[model samples]
Target: MKVLVTGAAGFIGFYVSKVLLEKGHEVVGLDNVNDYYTADLKYDRLNELGISKKEAEIFKRKSVSSKYSSFAFIRMDLEDRTHLPSLFENESFDAVCNLAAQAGVRYSLENPEAYVDSNMVGFLNILECCRNHKIKHLVYASSSSVYGLNEKIPFSAEDNVDHPISLYAATKKSNELMAHTYSHLFQLPTTGLRFFTVYGPWGRPDMAMFLFTDAIVNNRPIKVFNYGNMERDFTYIDDITEGVVRVIEKPINDRLNEKEYYKLYNIGNNNSVKLSDFINEIENNLEKKAEKQMLPIQPGDVERTWADVNGLIRDYGYSPDTPIKEGVKNFIDWYRSYYKI
Candidate 1:
């Protein structure tokens, strides 16, 4: 199958693109490569997929991978309706994994417009392109953050996500809504995978795991939000890619008849681990104690997030079960090797 993976340079998207290529699928990658964190890390991820940094830095110029004949990448934003339409017409992608978005939750408080442009406007363009191009499947990333302040134990797709605490969560919920509109009216097969706290090797620098490890290694104090009372269903990168692939390949769920082809599932570890325990794992792997600075939870932050992944397991015959210890060790090893620490 031919697949177009948006946000191909991102942590999760990078792994997903590689796995698709390994499975003998033709892949076209796309990302604006904005410096939300740092464009250097984004380029490095592309480098791993056999695309040169020189080749990917240029905007709108599609470059075929130096290593993988089945893979190619383009530096472009999703909100570019003019070019996005043409790209869809030219590629005629069989499926699209729309992982591109403005990303950070707390950052949304700083720049709410970024979330609207990338998550809302950009997503609308994806729907229009998929609808016009008649793409078979549109598998996109959603977030567990949509659950917001709900007291729900294991966040389920069926749970009400109408009240989001942050702009980022609101945008993700809006994506699911927008996808549902397309799926219902156009019969497009759309699936929204609400990802939990995904962490592993090649992870994003802005994410908690990376921040904690980096601060610990540098002997800087690590912030313990909610005073270390938080919990997260931290999933590994490989598990996320596997689940994404399954959703991209599998047929529409039973909920979809001729009426609506929309599906939503929580992609998570199905188990929550306390923040203190997670930090402890990092400390164990690095063999260095962290100078913890306990602080109140920041705004737009939830104390805990646990995804109810029964729907995913029932539909995909898969579950994310990588032990926290193993995942942390893999990440620590990569961090050390990548940084020469």
Candidate 2:
């Protein structure tokens, strides 16, 4: 199968692209390579997939990597509807996994426009392309943040997600609604995966795992948000990749009895870990006690998050079993190696 994976330079997207290439599938990766984090880190992720910094810098449409014969990359943004359509028309992608978006929930509070442009306008372009190109299925990245103040311990896709706490969460929830519209109007098959606390090697710098690891290794103070009362389903990257691959292979199809080919699933570890416990794993793995600065939870931050992935397990045999200790160890090892720490 020929697959188009947006956010190819991103953490999850890069891993997913590599796996797909290894499986002998043709993959065309697209990413804007924005500086939400360091562009160097994004470039390094591309480098792992055999894309050169020189090639990435020039906004190349198609760069064939030396390592993966089945892999190609395009430096493009989802908001650029003109180029997006042209690419879709030219490549004729079989399936698309949309992971490109302005991601940070906290950052969204500061820069709301970025979220609107990337998450809202950007997603519409994807839907339009999928609809026009007759793509078989479109799998997109939603967020557990969409469950926002629901007071539900384990969030389900069936639950109403109308009260998103941040602009980021609002946009994520909006994506689900837009996907359903496309699925209904054009009979396009779409699936949205609400990811929860995804972390591992090559993880985003803004996330807690990366932040805490960096601070601990550098002998800097790590900010303990919500006074260390926070809880999260710190899902491992491998588990997320597996769930994504499974969903991609099995495209949702609207039956005579069903309304449309639209579905959503929570891709996360069911086990929730307290903030202190998580930090303990990181500290133990790094052999360094982190200097902690207790802080009140920032706005747009949720007290806790847990995912209900039973639907995923039943439908596609999805199971996330990576322990935090193991995941943190892998991350710490990668961090040390990557930074020469």
Candidate 2 global CA lDDT score: 0.91
Error of 2 at 51 (Å): 0.7
The TM-score of candidate 1 is 0.98
lDDT of 2 by residue, 92-208 (tens): 899999999999999998999999999999999999999988999999999999999898778887898989899999999999999999888998899999999999999999999
Pairs clashing within candidate 2: none
The clash count of every prediction, one per candidate, is 0, 0
Candidate 1 scores a C-alpha RMSD against the true structure in Å of: 1.1
Clashes of 1: 0
Off by over 4 Å in 1: 253-258
The lDDT for every candidate, in the order shown, is 0.92, 0.91
* Distance from true location, Cα of 153 in model 2, Å: 1.2
Give the top-scoring candidate (lDDT).
1
Q: For candidate 1, which ten residues in a row score worst on lDDT?
A: 251-260
lDDT of 1 by residue, 22-71 (tens): 99999999999998988888999999999999999888889999889999
What TM-scores do the predictions have? Answer: 0.98, 0.98
